[model samples]
Target: MADLSTDIALDDERIVRALEEDIIFGRLAPGARLTEDSLLSRFPVTRHFVRQALVQLEQMGIVVRERNKGATVRSLDPEEVQQIYAVRELVQRQAALLIPLPAPQALVDQLLAIHKEHGEHIESGYLRGVHETNDRFHLTLFGACGNKYLVQTIELYMRYSLPVRANSMADRAALDISHSQHRLMIEMLQGRDNWVLAQLCVDHLQPSKRRYIDLVGH
Candidate 1:
């Protein structure tokens, strides 16, 4: 029974991750309905597992469940986008400021490796790989702040901004800019200027926020 339970839990987690990747890579656009019947047909999981996955996604701010409307990919309005991004800027900048100057060689090396992978994904037009590696890069960079709570907050806001950031993920120019910025961030990590690093981190978020606002007509 314990083994069965573990298998079920792992199955549920797989469903959740698959759905999350769909949403992240734009296969599931904002406001696209996530009907039970469709999900049931798509994954080999039971209905209970599907429901559990939806609940988890809702909790993650990636999906919305309405009273009579069912679950759909989250769609953030311009104001909500602005507000969420404002919070993102604050927490991200704070996290950057907290990192020790002349960051540990280990952290810099890890970031450089991830940055290289990110650039390759961008060049290859692998949207999913691009998104995942880009996220890994930022999270790893902020993780060096040595404050778990701050990193957690930054991560939460990053998730919340997904809808706003989605469109840019597929834009070639945006991807190139992001790739270049990652290189700059790695270079800055080897220096002793925390403020410059902090500012760079903050600036990194602007293009997406501005692009989202403009596209949504605010």
Candidate 2:
């Protein structure tokens, strides 16, 4: 793995995001221990920042802290994965429905820009770029629901969904499909069709959920 500290600033949020990128890219594998000494060396940060990053990751359910063990990336169990996806499906579908029909041109253009960046990152195989852009794409799309609390809930569950989805950003075929879905979603917004868009949102999530469950059975 490349040294993250070289290119990026190491603040608490950036450090946590860096670790999450590492986890998603498979550089930090499931159940990998995130020791203070190890993290301190990886980034040009003090133990204070490292501890803060781990705590933030813990709250996001990407990492867990146990007595005397410090912290390790959380492993997703199949049952829990199913339940999370169930709720995620519901929330995402509802969010889709709530988006104002005839999405403003400004919002559509913003989504288009983000999706374009996602394509560029996927083509270059920049895993972290792809990850961050993907998050922005989804967050921007769902945030259009115009309910801050709903957006917050969706974002929270999206973070919790990360454990199972960690390595998915690396799959080229998966990225292709995902990007295509993003295009379809953009079209849905253009057409101002809520029901079809809602269904598409639900369908879009199934591939990753199914792929994860198949790889890691309950």
User: Which 10 consecutive positions of candidate 1 have the poorest summed lDDT?
Assistant: 1-10
Give per-residue CA lDDT, model 1, range 13-76, as digits (tens): 9998898888877898888999999999999888998998899999889999998889999998
Q: Candidate 2 residues 3-55, lDDT tens each?
A: 76643344887898888878888888878999999888888877888888888
lDDT scores for all predictions?
Answer: 0.89, 0.88
Q: Which candidate has the top score in lDDT?
A: 1
TM-score of each: 0.94, 0.89
- As for candidate 1, its clashing pairs are none
Give RMSD (Å) of candidate 2 vs. truth. 4.6
| lDDT of model 2, residue 16 | 87
lDDT accuracy of residue 158 in candidate 2: 89
